[model samples]
Target: MQALYDVPAPAKLNLFLHVVGKRPDGYHLLQSIFTLIDWADTLHFERRGDGRLARHDGADAMAELPEDDLCLRAARLLRTESGDAALGANIHLEKRLPAGAGMGGGSSDAASTLLALNRLWGLNWPLARLLPLGLKLGADVPFFLGGRNAFVEGIGEILHPVDLPAQTYFVLKPPTSIATQEIFSSPLLARSKSVAIVAGFPAHNSSDDKNESLQSTGAEVVKLDAQGVAKLCGGFGSNDLQKPAEAICPEVRQALQLLEARYGNSRMTGSGSAVFARVSSEEKDGMSNQSMATMLQDLPGAWTGKICRGLDRHPLSGWA
Candidate 1:
């Protein structure tokens, strides 16, 4: 029996997202650096002769996503594109990350499926071919396929490889999930800032190169060495959707405030209800097992949390 087991679909955080403008199609123009994290959902696939796609875990039994799952769709798309009928696999997802926390769980899952099936089916589709299909899955899906750190832009499809500092983070998800589209459409959303682009990474938060309208009022400069980068992920980086998300979900606001109080540099990831803090690498060694336990114990009765390390690369490509 040809089988592949324990493939990783890693989560990601947008270190910072700047909305340059909106396109004619109503998609927002964005510029951000995305880094993969070690926190992941695992998939196990066993080739089946019967050609049926099955998911044994991860998704809720009543969650209604199995029928519309990107994982299954990815497999189907690959099969159709390659014109192969003898390929099939039984997928078992070991879901660890929370859904809709803006952690890219589903997109990661879909990308992993595309990769695993490409190998298992022996079709040998190049990453470029797999990418357009993955875009059909999610904007974030293609980044995982790129398999390296990137400066992403243009509704999250265009990608440019970047050399990003490696780091670890403590990501905390509140009890609620914020819908991505709703956050984008909020009337309270700040969208009038002049679209500005910096030539290179600024010194964590000097904002000297940023336009006045695009600068955060509370921004602070931070120094991140390799070790410091591994621990505390630079300074208090900002996300465009955070304010709107917080305005709609008080739980998200509370999560950010609490993490900031303890960790100093805290912010929400993606279109979040999840907030994270930059812990110094030295501090990370001290907490390895104890910090998560301590933080969870202290968390409000209504939240879910985890300690996620920043990755200089996506997890799946380590397989390639």
Candidate 2:
């Protein structure tokens, strides 16, 4: 293919993020479950026979982005590893997901870049070969490349396939961006002591005492209905980083309050500056698109919000 148009890099929500431990190298060991969302950034790629890689992104977004962003870094790394100096591409990114919202926008884009370039350059690399290169780009990169919901651990390198029923969410991004370091370095960060069991879960609600009785029974995936989703997620832990994120960025707290007031519950996903609430099937059916749009229009300038649905896998899952 001469071009890959409208390639999507979907954002991820950490349904539950727990800081389990710390490595001697200073990287915090974490355990979380990541699920893809319908809200995503779109990328367009065209073969560049000139051997010059170029990324055309929104000027304002570029100003906010690091000089050597993940997209460029991914492209360079893939090309170098391919041992094909002549391979190049022109990448255009339509930045839809807000930056620093803890939604994995940049990492998803980088994953998409590697997948698109693999085909553009005729490398046809398998997922196994591409995964290590993805890790070098960012901790979240490999999860995106994994192409489905995952139980993530070990600084984001360990991943196990997870299955989540399709569900709706209301995600709100505040006007400000949060630097990840600010959240991690804070002394107020909390770590969870209890480990979450994801190997098996009930498909239906159980008695109070029976809830959260999960085990490693090799029953990972299940066919669940809308009501089953709540019981399944209730067993998962909370985002430990949320405490520090709210402290480091008051906007994170503000976003949480806003979502909670409307949706009845809200939690910070991943880190800070963005909060989300689960929308029940009845709530989603009653909500109209115009209402969702009006809510977003009411936000401050450059702030974004979306009524998104959880995805079964990345839109570009088959690309790699």
Q: Clashing residue pairs in candidate 1, if any?
A: 231-279, 231-280, 231-281, 232-278, 232-279
Give the C-alpha miss distance for residue 171 in model 1, angstroms.
Answer: 0.7
Give the per-residue lDDT digits (tens) of candidate 2, residues 1-320: 78989999999998778786777888887877788999999999888777778788765332223547888889889999988888878788999888888999999999999999998788999999999999998899999999998778788988777777789988988878878888888888865344555546432211344323334334555344555455434444578888888877787888888877887778788776788888888888888888888888887777678888899988878777
| lDDT for residue 223 in candidate 1, whole number 0-100 | 27
Instruction: Report, for every candidate in turn, its global Cα lDDT versus the true structure.
Output: 0.74, 0.80
Q: Residue by residue across 1-320, what tens digits does model 1's lDDT show?
A: 37889899988887777676776888887766677889999998888776677777655541223557888888888888887676778888889889888888999999999998888877677887888988887788888888976667767787766654556678898889988989999986766444444344333222333553222212122223464233324342357788899889999888887877877777778898777887766777777477679878888886787777677677667443
| Candidate 2 TM-score to native | 0.88
Global CA lDDT of candidate 1, please? Answer: 0.74
- The residue pairs found clashing in candidate 2 are none
Quick one: best lDDT, which candidate?
Answer: 2
State residue 267's C-alpha deviation in candidate 1, in Å. Answer: 1.0
